[model samples]
Target: MTTRDTTVAVFRPDDERLRDAVELVESLGATPVADPMLEVRETGASPRTDADYTVLTSKTGAEIARETGWEPGETTVCAIGSATAGALREQGYDVDLVPDEFSSTGMVELLAERVDGARVEVARSDHGSQVLLDGLEAAGAYVHETVLYELVRPEGAGGSAELAASGDLDAACFTSSLTVANFLAAAEERGIRADAVAGLADAVVGVIGEPTRETAESEGIAVDVVPENADFDELACAVVERAAPTYHD
Candidate 1:
């Protein structure tokens, strides 16, 4: 039996997407741990009136807005990527723009062509990166942001912290800055060493976007791979390949 000590810790909510990552890990014969660091909560309402554009960056955003309800009719919906666009479309929102690249900067670039001086409301995580908001505002879009959710880790990560403390994890996947921050907070709560987490600099530390990569680097974690896009599937495949190439089924 080729028992690999590699483990890929996914700090995402226990959504279908988490399951997808778990399946990917199993296909590679590696252990998959569900170590969610953030909880997504859809809050508030359409804070702006007659928003010419609505920007959704994650599936949680789409679901929150859909559940909260919005005025019917065509509102140019811009998404960070295809996956988010699909999520918006499935929820009955007409997706007008889905950038080729996946990031707030990407979405801002995509919106430049269709909006300028137009009121735009962004449904985003409570702790959001300023790139998108700054870029869009610079591009002359009337940007308003609504904190749709917060990402928090589960009560305790079981004994996963001990594994990372001992450098047992071959890799860890951080999909968002919140996930990265929350994961570190959880580790500290469990008395894990900073070096043990940073050791992934030599191993596989997967990030979903530039912002996430930047955060990981700042935390002294070696980021071995960042997908071409921010889609979870793209990230999952990249992490699996980087950490356990031979384990791939």
Candidate 2:
């Protein structure tokens, strides 16, 4: 592996998770460009209790649901990923279903056969993909979505984009499609969208999963790393390894 110094850009929310991500990058001997692209705005809403199935797509949604007194009394609870499941369990909600793939497509696939003709309530951020709702509807289920929160780009969040434009970004870990969109928007705001994209082409770009990868690719970003499991830690590790491939004898 190359021992050369690496500077990686991370776009996690400005919270504990961001700190953890920066710590992970440091442990891998890379300089971290800590920029928060997503900010959570709670909508003060909760899942309806009448649904036959309840879906939570993110950790923020689960946390907000718990905060808003959403008790899943007899409702078959589903989570999009392990982190969301863990959040539900932490709040004393029993998670009954977790898709193997950990994405909207995965959730729809997991419930397609079983949720036919059933009432499925999806409670999540406003940035959720229409694919989930359309897939569930096509599978013959009645789907209702409640926006638990909204994910917005934090103000003045494109410093990393400028760094990337200047050719200082060695890698970027994009955890979601919205983050990719937000990053580009910030870059565009700074009038450096083209330069930033060009710079990113010269560096290793890693996305959390297929959905994120698709979004990045659709925007002309070349994705170099996608971990088998769609989680932040796994994504981060894979990207770091790509930035400076693992050494061997």
Candidate 3:
């Protein structure tokens, strides 16, 4: 196997996950640009009540729910993604279900068989799409949602612009539509024009799935990985395989 050094920019936020990514990059002998283009803010709380089921959509949701002392025993918690599931588990809740696809549709499919007219409460970001709740309600399940947090676009994508301008970035991974949109916005805020951004067309743009890929494609960035599933491992492997010439060529 050929090992080539890659410089990658992570446009999410300066969180524990960012620290983990930094460590991973160092382990691989690759450079990581910590450009925090998205800031997560806890903005709402779910009142303590008897809920039959709880849907944890993101780590932010899990954190906020944990902070607000959401009890796990009374409610069967279903995490939308594995990362969220891990977060919930760390917070002492046994995650009953995790979607294989890691999207609203996938969650809906799994939930359709599990919930037996249970009252479901969704803990999620304020600005996230309502597809999960809508799907659950359409399937004859009692569902309600509480906004746990909001994702604010950062002032600018400082690190991404610097890495891209120096032509050092081999790839950038976007996990969500918000990440892709805010990363580009941050690049523009740091004075990167359309032509300059487009010039990195050869750079591998790794996206989690179709929605994120669509957002990146709309911004004119070349997507090298639109994984069959939206799992984090799949995304990471896809990025490594596609960005390295030895793996793809």
Question: Against the unseen true structure, what C-alpha lDDT does each candidate score?
Answer: 0.74, 0.90, 0.73
The lDDT-based order of candidates, best leading, equals: 2, 1, 3
Candidate 3 lDDT, 1-249, residue by residue in tens: 243567666665778877876666545555666777678877757633567878888877877888888776677778887788888888777888788888888888888876657788887887666778888887778887788877888664566765665676777778888887777676677677464366457577788878788877887777877877666556666676666655444
Q: What are the per-model C-alpha RMSD values against the true structure?
A: 2.2, 1.6, 3.0
lDDT for residue 29 in candidate 3, whole number 0-100: 51
Listed in order, each prediction's TM-score against the native is 0.90, 0.96, 0.86
Candidate 3 ranges with C-alpha deviation above 4 Å? 1-5, 113-117, 245-249
lDDT of 2 by residue, 1-249 (tens): 252378888999998889999998888777888999999999888899999999999888888998999888888999999999998898888999999998899999999999889999999999899999999999999999999998999998998899889998889999999999999999999999999999999999999989899999999999999999878889877887888875211
Name the top TM-score candidate.
2
Q: Residue 168, candidate 3: how far off, in angstroms?
A: 3.7
Residue 105 of model 2, lDDT score: 96
Error of 3 at 215 (Å): 1.5
Window of ten residues with lowest summed lDDT in model 2: 240-249
Error of 2 at 198 (Å): 0.6
Candidate 2: count of backbone clashes, pairs at least 3 residues apart or interchain: 0
Provide the clash count, candidate 1.
7
